[model samples]
Target: MGPTLDSSYEDWVRVAEGVVPPGRHRVGGREEDGAGAVFAVVSPRDGSTLASVADAGEKEVDLAVAAARWAFDSGPWPRLAPAERGRVLLRIADLVEEHRSEIAALISLENGKPIAESYGIELRAVAGTFRWYGQLADKVCDEAPHTDPGALALVTREPAGVVGAVVPWNFPLTLAAWKIAPALAAGCAVVLKPSELTPLSALLLGRLVDEAMEEAGVPGGVLNVVAGDGPTAGRALGLHPDVDVLAFTGSTAVGRHYLRYSADSNLKRVWLELGGKSPNIVLPDAPDLDAAAATAAWGIFFNQGEMCTAPSRLLVHSSVAERVTDAVIQRAEALRVGDPLDPATEMGALAGAARLDAVRGHIDAARAAGARLRTGGAPLDPAPVPGGTYLRPTVFDRVTPDMAVAREEIFGPVLSVLTFDTVEEAVALANDTEYGLAAGLWTGDLSTAHTVSRALRAGTVWVNCYEEGDLTVPFGGYKQSGNGRDKSAHALEKYTELKTTWIQL
Candidate 1:
C-alpha cells in the first residue's frame, strides 16, 4: 500500500517524530543514508533526539565533490540545451510548490522558526527564488565590443564547475536556494553543506531535486548534500582544489577562514555573505512615531533578530528618541515567544543552546559596560515550551556606536537604541558598523531619504520597512559583510564564468 498523506501539521509532527520516518537523502537515485551509525539530529524545541544522520566526514565530502565534478565536466547537464535546462529548473520549482507544506514543516522543525511564517512566507520566497532563477537561466547574455574594424569577437558564459555551497542556519532553505538555484541555472553542479542546526530541510531539498530532475530528465549526480560541522566538512569543501567555487553564508571570522583556505588551496572563487550590524535611522521629521516604532521593532526582532541583514541598531533622532524607545519597548515586550510549532507563536527560539548563551553573554557585557536595559534580560522561565533554545526579546538603551553591543553583530532578538541629535550625527552613527548589509531610514522628508540613501553605506536601504525583498532585486553587503551579489540576474554571474572568443577571417 502507498503511504497515506497527513493533512494537518499535528499529524505530520506525530509521523515525523518516528510514528512514520522522516525521509532520507536521494544520492544517485536511491535512499542511501538516513540514520545509520552516525551523528544525531536533535530538536532544539524540546531537545529530544530526532534522527541520527551519516557522520559525513572528509571522505563523504570528497565523494560528494567527485559526484558534482563528474556532473559538471562529463555529464549531460552542463551540456544540455539552455532552454531544456531552464524548463527542468521550472519543473523543480513546480515540485517545490507541490511539496510546499512538507518542506515548510521541515524548515520550521529544523530551524526553529514559526510554522505559519515558514509555510506562509519563507517557503513561498524560496519557490520564487527557484522560479526566478529558472527564468534567468536562458536570459544571461554576453556582449562583444565593437572597437576593431577587421577583427571578430564572440563572448559566452559557462558554468563555474563544481560549486561548494555552505549555507547558514538562520534561513536554511531560503539561503540554500539563494545559492543553489543560480548555480544550477548557470549549469554548475553543487555540493551543499547546510548548517548542522538545520540540515533537515536541505536534505529534504536534495530529495525533491532528485525526484524533480528524474521527472524533468536532469542527469544523476548533478546535486549532492552532506551535513556536518563547519570546521570539518565545510572547511574541507572550501579547501578542495577540485571545487571551482565556494559560496558561503556565515560569520566574519569563519568567512576569513574560508577565504584563507580558498586562497591556499586553488585560488578558487570564494563568495561570502557575512555578518551585519545594520542601522534603522528614524529622523526627527518622521510623521508617525507609532508606525516607525512598530516597523523598527519588526526590523530588530523579526525571526528573533537572527537575520543577517537585520537592523540591530536603532539610530533615533534626539527629538523622538524617548517616544520611539518607549513605543518600541512596548512592542518588544508584547512579542509572543513560545513553541515555533504553535500557530500563535510570533517569535521562536534561538538556533540552539549555544546561541542562547551567546545572546546572554552579549547582554551581560552590555550591562557591565553600563548600558541600560529597557526590557528582557534573561531567558523565559518555566520555559515557553519543553526544550527549545528560548530567550525573551531584549532591548538595550543608551547604546553608543562604539559599544560592543552596538558595533558587533549579535545574531539574536537584541535591540540597541541610540539617540542622535543631527542628521549628520545620525548618518555617522548608522554607518559606524563594519557591516553594510542593510539599513532602514524613516523620514517624512524626501530630501532626507535621498540624502541618507546615498550616504548610508549599506547595500539595501529600506525607507519605511525592513526585511523586504523580491527576486528582482540584488542582495549583498559592503565592507566585511562579504562580497558578490545574490538574487536577480546578477546572482548568475557568481556561478557562471565569461569567456571571450576572437575570430579573424
Candidate 2:
C-alpha cells in the first residue's frame, strides 16, 4: 500500500498524527507512557510542531522489554516457520512502498531533507531493505565444525532476543530499516529509540509495523518504539539487562558511550556504524575531470552532507587541484535550497537548528585556525517557506592535514580541499583521519587505483564512482569508525548468535 496523497498543511498534520496516533507508549500491548511527560516533535523544514509523545522513562523501558521477552518466549514469532516470517516481512515492505510518499514527507518535515529525493529515492531504498532481507530470512544458517572422531559437534545460529536499536536523525527511516529488517528477519523483537530531533518516522514505523504484522499475523509486542532523548530512552535501551543485543548508527563519541553502557549489563552483543571523515581523492590523471568533479559535488553535498559517508575531505593531486576545486565550488553555488517538497530542490537544509549551529561553529573554528573559505561560509536566509534551517554549502581551500576542518567529522555540506604532490603523499593524507567509513579514489591508472584502494584503511572504497552500491555489499568502518557490518548476508550474523552443541559418541 503506497501513501495517500495529502493536499494541505492540515492534511499533512492529520497524516502525521494518524501515523503514530496521539498516545503514550505501547507497553505490554496497551497505550501508555511510563514516567516522563509529553514532548513535541517539530519539523525542521518550517519549525512546525508534528506530534507530542510521552518521554518514556525506565518504567516504560522495563515494560517494553518485558513485553518483548514475553513475545519472544511465548509468542508465535520465535516459533513460527522462517517462511512465515518472510511472508510478513514481504507484507511490511509492500505497505512501506505503498506509504512511501507519506513516510518520506514525514521524514523530510522532521529530518529536513528534500521531499522529492528523500521520499522518491531514499524511501524506496528503505522499503527495499525489508524486501531484500525478507527473501534472505530462510537463507541464514550455520555449519557443523570439524571435530575429533571421539566427539560429535554441531554449530547453530539463533536470534539474539530483544534488540535495542538506537538510530540517529540523519536518514532516520533508512537507517532504522538497516537495524529493524535484519533483527526481525533473524527473529528478534526490537525496542527502537529514534533520535529526538526526528521521531515522527520512527513513530510512523510503529504504526506500519502494527498494520503489517496484523496482516501477516505477527504477534503484538514484537516491535516497539520509544520516543525520547538519548540519556533517557537511549540509555534505557543500551543498558537494559533484558535487551540481548544493542545496534546503533550514530557519532563515534556516542557509539563509545553505548559500548560502555552495554558492557555493564549481560555483555549483550553491540553493533555500531559510526562517524567518518572519509576522503574523496582526485588523482593527477583522473579519466573524466567533469564527471569526477560532479560526483565529488554529490559526494559531499548530497543530503546537505548530513551523511556519515559524506566525503568531506577532498584530497586532490596538485596537477588537477585547481580545476577540481573550481568545478566543485561552481556546482555547490548552483544548488537550490528551498522547500523540500519541491521536486526541483537539489539541496535541503541541515537537519535542525542545533545541527546548523554545530556546522557554523566548525566553519568559524576552521576560519579562526587559518583556513581560507572559498565560498558559502554561512547559512542562507530563511527561504519563502520561512523558518527553514538552511545553509549554503561551504568549501575551504588550502586545508592542511592538522586542521580541525580536515580531521573532524563536520557532518555538514562543508568540503575541505587539500593538495598533495605525489601518489605516496596522497595516500598518506587520505588515511590521516581517525575515521575509516568510506573513501573515493579517481584515477585513470589501473595500478594506482588498485594500490590506493588496498592502502586506504576504510570499510568501503569507491574506485571511480562515489556512493554507488546496492544492498548486497558489506558496509562498516575501521579504526575509530566503530565495528560490525551492515547490509548483505553478513548483517544477519550480528543479530544472530552462534551456539555449539557437542555429544560424546
RMSD of each: 2.7, 2.5
Cα displacement (angstroms), candidate 1, residue 4, comes to 18
- Highest lDDT model number: 2
Compute the lDDT for candidate 2.
0.84
Please, what's the RMSD in Å of model 1?
A: 2.7
Backbone clashes, each candidate: 2, 6
lDDT of 2 by residue, 325-438 (tens): 999999999988777766567887778778889999999999999999999978786563688788898999988999999999999999999999998998899888899999
How many times do residue backbones clash in model 1?
2
lDDT of model 2 at position 226? 80
How far in Å is the alpha carbon of 356 misplaced in model 2?
0.9
**TM-score for model 2?**
0.95
TM-score of every prediction relative to native: 0.95, 0.95
